[model samples]
Target: MSYPAVPRRSAVANAIYGLFNPIPFGFFVAALIFDIIYAKTGTILWAKSAAWLITLGLIFAIIPRLVNLTQVWITSRRFSTGADHVDFWLNVVAIVAAILNAFVHSRDAYAIMPAGVWLSVLTVALIAIGHIIIAVRYSTDREYFHG
Candidate 1:
């Protein structure tokens, strides 16, 4: 019986790939931290709820990353050329969305309410699309490995 060899990766690439393995857990931790902070700060109940909801969304967002990490850990053992770039952009979009949400809730008018709403909506949509793409790619790659 013959078995396929695992793809080799450099130390740095392996370490970077490994770093992503905990993204889901880290996201959960971050969400909990945000919830605690918001609650402690005495923000309005609605604001606290918003923070919690956003955190939940973040947890959802991390699922695809976790899936990709599993594939990399078991097979490639490296970040694919575009994976890191995709992660970076996805994070950027998420952060921008979060900032826009904060601005909208703060009511300080740092950004116009309409603009903030649009930004937040666009960011969320981008994040969702990115996750779907990553999840599909990871599943496909995993199947290739097993086959």
Candidate 2:
């Protein structure tokens, strides 16, 4: 099972993807840090800050994810291996977890303690795994989409 050779993205699309793809990772990492700080200090400010960061991460993730969705599923007829699907689903699940974490953070500050931290951890882990998958696939596959 190999992906069909689709036309490469326009330079503008590549530029947009290159610019935005890693932004969410940074935001998510920051959110995780804030989550940890909130957990340790029991500060409402930290919890609120983390919620904002996660929201920002999701916002930043949109463009790259849309590009990925089109390239991996809509354009390609098949994946060379299962890793592509794993990477996509990992990202999707991470986004879902972050959304849930954001909702959890919307509650009263103290109420968000352990659950917020756990969700943040889970989201970060999933995103990290997704990125790792991409890195590994890119190293192995000559036709990897991201160039």
Q: Supply every candidate's count of residue pairs whose N, Cα or C atoms clash at under 3 angstroms.
A: 0, 0
lDDT of 2 by residue, 1-147 (tens): 576564455577668877998899899899999989988998778988998999999999899888777767776526435776887789899899989988998999689888988998898899889889878877866656544
Sequence-dependent TM-score of model 1: 0.46
Best by TM-score: 2
lDDT of each: 0.52, 0.83
The TM-scores, one per candidate, come to 0.46, 0.84
| Local distance difference test, candidate 1 | 0.52
**Model 1 lDDT, residue 2, Cα:** 75
Where does model 1 exceed 4 Å of error? 1-78, 108-112
What is candidate 2's local distance difference test score?
0.83
Model 1, range 1-147, lDDT digits (tens) per residue? Answer: 675665555566447545653453344344444444544564455344544555555555554555445544444545454664575467556655765555555553222334434544565556566667667877877887886
